[model samples]
Target chain A: MRPILISCHTRPVIAVKFNKDGDLFFTGSFDGKVSVFWSEPVERLGTFACDGAVKTMTVTEDSKYIVIGTAINGIFIFEVETGTKVKTIEFSSKIHVRDVEFAMGSQQFFMISYESDEKKQSVVYIYDFESVLNREQPSRRDLVRRDRDHYYRGVWGYLNKTIVLGTQNGIIDVVDTKTGELLLSHRAHVNQITSLAFSPDFSMLITASRDCFAKLLDPETLKEIRVFNAQRPLNSAVISPLMLNEGSPKYHCLVAGGQEARDVTTTATDQGGFEITFYNMIFEREIGSVRGHFGPVHSVAVHPRGHMFVTGSEDGTARVHILDQDYFTPAYD
Target chain B: MADADYIEREHIEATADGTYKITTHIKIQNKTVITNPDIERRKTLPKFGDCKNLSKGDIEGSINIEDKEVFLQKSSQVRAEENITKFNLNRAHKEKLDALTRRERAIMSGETEEQKTRRPIVTEREEFSVKVSNLPDNIDQDVLQNLFGTAGRVRKVFIPRGRDDNLPRDFAFVHFDTKAEAEKAIKQFKDYPLGHHILSVEMADRRNQRRNVPMSNRRGRK
Candidate 1:
């Protein structure tokens, strides 16, 4: 399938996410802007600006508000429709927010921040989403803290009772938000876990690590279910919603990453693995790959309906690919 | 044969390109005509030839004028003698040509009898060297010599480094005084824990000396 190339960010794009309805998608970049685009026609709708380079961002379940985390140790909330700033939360100058996500079905959200110091401290904070939306002081609390290994990504489990965090040491930690207790910790890979994603049904959690492995695990118990191995380090992985459908479904997963940015200058583009790879989720075999990005792909987000997916890359572009009809058939198996 | 009424007409004309165009027309009164019974009967009759009364084998034997066994035996005797002479001549010529080509090939490839019999010189240091790999990056030659000196009398220690960065690689070679001492060092240092990594020691294989050269100097030659 040919992808619709959306190039607006002036710097490398770090994150791309789709709304719950899959009608609109957003791309966050180091240029300090989050541009929203229509998923079907792939037209730029509007852009929200912040004061610092965007590290990560997440939209509310209703697609009404967006929370952006920036490298300047600030978290900015904006109303999606008007592109108006709603709230701004600042941290110490040395602390930069890495990831943020909304709770499954509540007025709460979580943010993972890391300190740029020798200790490499990481802390996860939970905020009351409604208060932030009202431009009031949001009730916040530290849910988890680490001094050695940094937490790169985190996602709420099931119904927000548990939060699954992926750490720098390839460890997946499941923490209870109410008690702030560590429930389970499992070493998911051999290197740092770069991203964490949950399947559409929230039954399985997929973790992408710098060790060139993406694994599916039971979110509650942290038990390994399946493993997808690649040649280069994987930055992001997403499971197709069609894989869990009641009708005829395709068991496919999308994984995107490439060689490290530092070594890209000395490596050839093709050999650097600058493409999104498709793997058979059940068989754990690579089916095919889509090549377009000139640099490493940093993030990939699939539509809720599984018909389209968007990839953000270090090439400063986000490509939206609407899957062809032939993808629905089980040809890879 | 049946007689039928027919009319025939012809028209000729000269036109462009200096070519003649002719048109012939025929009109038949009867749609069908009967064939001659006598001719049909003649066609159905069996054919008669000179060997009509002879059997199949008799006809074949008459056509073959020579005696089969005698002709085959005589031809075989002649061909066998010819093949013997040809085979001997070809064998002698091939042997001579093979030797000539072998000598030419050896000369082309710069291979002589002396070159084939000669062996490469091996120094005592190379024969008594042991390669230690998986060493810590911060390790130095002095530390390596001190660590390996317990096995035997250490002659020399060398650590390879990166050409561009000049940082030491993860391996080093230690030369002992004798082969037995080298073997003792290999046995003793195998899997020896140094820093956080285990050391792997083995006899140095000097067959490919290219690996011992620096990267920048080794390029463009092979």
Candidate 2:
């Protein structure tokens, strides 16, 4: 199936996420802009600008506010409807916010930041979402402080009680949000972890890494369930929501990545591995792949309803793909 | 003896041309006719295979007798066998699910046996090597290594030479330890000036050697 290409960003796109209703999706780019697009018709709705390059972003479950983390060591919250800047928190310039995520159905969100100072520490900060928007000084707490491992991405665990963090050294850590306690830690890959995603029901966690493997894990215990192998380093891995449906379940997951951007110029288009690869989640086998991005794909987000998915790439474009009717059929085997 | 008798009256006339004409009148009788009862009865009889009194069993066989005690008993037996197999299959499926870990069961609950048995597709790994062309005749492996060394770790460098001339060729292949390094070299050194000539750098395309062309034949041709 052909994809709807959205080329608005001037630099590499770092993150793409869908709102709770799945009708709209937002893409955050290194160009310091976030674009909102309608998922069905694949039209650009609006754009939000950040002072610094956007590294990661998340929309609230109500789709009312968006939290943007940028390279300038700042987190900005804006009203989704009016595009008004509701709150802005600036940290010391040494720390680069790597990931930001909103807790499901709660006035709480957390961000992971890396400090490139003498200590070389990674920090996970949990903040009260309501305080950030309504109060003059927002209340925040460091869940994991001065950690040695460089965390690349963080995803909220089930019920928003814990947060899962993937690090540059291939370690996965689950930290309790309330008590600031490390719940579980395990070495999950051989190389740096690039992204982490949860299944629609939060029953499984998929982690993609620079080691050319995306793994399925138990969110609570950090146990390995299955592994999907690829030829190139993976930047993002997401499980399709259709697998959780009670009727006509589709056992599929998508992983997108390629040769690093520095290497892309030397490799041919076919050999670059710049495609979103589909894997059978149940069987852990490669089913198919969609190729479009000239550069590596950095992020992918599947619609909540499982009808479509959006991918952001280093090519400075985002693609919205409405899955073919054949993807929903159980005929892969 | 006769129901009605035909009466004829004749009249003769002569014209001036002496031509005579005769006129005659005749009386006819009418009578009612009766049909043969045997022939009518034969016409109303049913044709072949059109009898109303025929039973379904008469046309086919006693296999249509579904309500018989023996037939019912055999069907019940077949159904019981089918139920037993289905029950066994369900039990086997439950056993398989129970054998899986909690996480695996959560991820692979709805997958069938055939789908689980399918293997993953395997892809070939790429080698990191760059081909450098348009080199000076006096260029050696050291100069090439030093030039590409800024990009990444150099694994190996090879320069082919003519057997008779025993001199280095104008082209060389450089292998890097990683794809990133090779890409960096290509980017930094493409069309790089070297000894009055610019070097052309690109990714090495390694095609499979021709199996039909034997090495001995190739050497002979050379």
A87 in model 2: Cα distance from truth in Å? 1.6
- Report the C-alpha lDDT of model 1 over B1-222, residue by residue, as the tens digit: 132454545566767777675655455655687874533442232312222353322322211212211100112353355566655654553465456556547766999867544434444334467888999877877898888889999987877777678778898888777889998998898899999999999888764433574452454244
DockQ, prediction 1: 0.01
> TM-score for chain A of every candidate model?
0.96, 0.97
Each model's lDDT: 0.77, 0.76
What's model 2's lDDT at A321?
Answer: 76
Where's the lowest-lDDT run of ten residues in candidate 2 chain B? B65-74
Q: Which sections of candidate 2 miss by over 4 Å?
A: B1-222
Count of backbone clashes, every candidate in sequence = 0, 0
Q: Which residue pairs come into collision in candidate 2? A: none
